[model samples]
Target: MRAKRCVYVVTAVLPLFLLGPARPAPAADEPFPAGRDRFSSPAADERFPAGRDRSWPLPGRPAVLRPWAPPPTPHARGHRGVDLAAPPHSPVLAVASGRVSFAGRVAGRGVVSVDLSGTGVPPLRTTYEPVRASVREGDEVTAGRPLGTLEPTVSHCPTTCLHWGLRRGRTYLDPLTLLPPWLLHPGSPVLLPVLGVPLPPPA
Candidate 1:
């Protein structure tokens, strides 16, 4: 019982200990340099949009069902974000290190939003929807941390899909741009017939 209590203490305090003051917003004209990771060093990462290709397999190798289509004008009819098809109840994850800004139900769907540190004046935010949250607002999370599980209900896509949105202030941007080119354009993957099969004891 004492050991169990100690484990809980560690879990609770670790996050607080790791959380740092949010990095300062970048200058208006200085743009994010090419070839930099959005979650990399504070000096280089600022001014870029948030998220990463590291989430390529989020919730289990999700496929892009709908691409981000920016509207010609705000309030115009256009898809605001990309939608990725994944099985219901699959675990959702944060694509980069950030602080949770929101985690709860909106309307009838679950949503989670994280403010990426050092993005800009408003700070770039990444959002996910149809997710039943496991993290809470103000919680600090690292890249690839599990934030929740995909909710069973979905509406944006014909099939179950996770809607990923990213924005700075009121303007939405391409979430994929945050990724380095190599990852964004990785060539088609080689097929593997079987996976996770352990070899028999070496002889």
Candidate 2:
């Protein structure tokens, strides 16, 4: 009888040990890693308009003159910008509100770079070149403000086009995806004031 009672006690204790403690359910307000905010605001489309006559620089006419040409090869492997299908000397504009960080040539790329900060959005980095820049470093710019005229030089591309590219920190992003919706259309023409003097290249 004592053996039977000991076996029953062991069986009850064994089940309790096996059960263990109950885990607390996850809280409703708990944040998940996958849902972390990556951008301050929603990402803009790639073909966002900068100003009048200027559209998102992408494959297709007016903006990106050569739809299929690859980016110019400066070195063997440094990919920096996109080729817009615009006519030579076509007006190019700033895509976001920021200060001009750089506005000159870097390794023959007609380099015009803008640092988009304090625009109620994340900082934007863009580069365009082989064109004449209107604004300089420290110049404050609004979205769609004219930065320069796309220079008519066949030196960079076989056909005339603006090489437009964007970055955030060190990550390269497709300019067309961040462009405004209206500029995405092939027929929309964005017109705005030409703010600075045109700095044409040497004759």
Candidate 3:
């Protein structure tokens, strides 16, 4: 009787031990090691200096300025921007992420200017004309996003291109240096070479 009771208890307890709670394996998409938080960084603010990337606004070769061309007339002052010779109606992309600060005409120049307002640095200003603007003031924009179409009627140049300008306050810096290395050919003698003119040393 005693041996039979012990055998029965062992059989009953063995099944209960074997039938422990089932734990499902974690799914493949679940992050390992349990809890983690993403998206912790502060939201991007373009106007601040820490937020902006000061690289060239567009990709590809920048339009070359003519060496012998007379400087802007006294009435017009100095050239405030560099002309990029592109075909008419070429898509114009934003240099960095920012808000559209200004978009309108400038007298006879038929100029249109877009001011980008974020990314910790000073606001970026791009000016062009005779082209339709796709963005309005306060609209947030990202780098390389299409801002508008380039129109050739404003400059009257043989080619339709963009006029890109970079500014830090009132001072103007050479826009070429701000471009990425791939856009420039290393070991090339100069950044921009004018026919018959001596080139300045690379900056």
Cα lDDT of model 3 by residue, 59-176, tens digit: 4555454211112222322444455666667777776666677665666443445565542345545555555677776777776777777765644445665666554444343334
* Candidate 2 residue lDDT tens string, 1-203: 66666665565556543553353332222122232222211243233334443334322334443222112231222334456667777778776677888888776656678876543344667777776888888898766788888888877567886777776664455665555445555353434333443433333
In model 2, the worst 10-residue window by lDDT is 67-76
Cα-based lDDT for every prediction: 0.68, 0.57, 0.49
Off by over 4 Å in 2: 1-80, 118-122, 186-203
Worst 10 residues of 1 by lDDT: 33-42
Give the winner by TM-score: 1 or 3.
1
Residue 147, candidate 1: Cα error in Å is 0.5
Better of 1 and 2 by TM-score: 1
Q: Which stretches of candidate 1 lie over 4 Å from their true place?
A: 1-54, 57-61, 187-203
| Candidates arranged by TM-score, highest first | 1, 2, 3
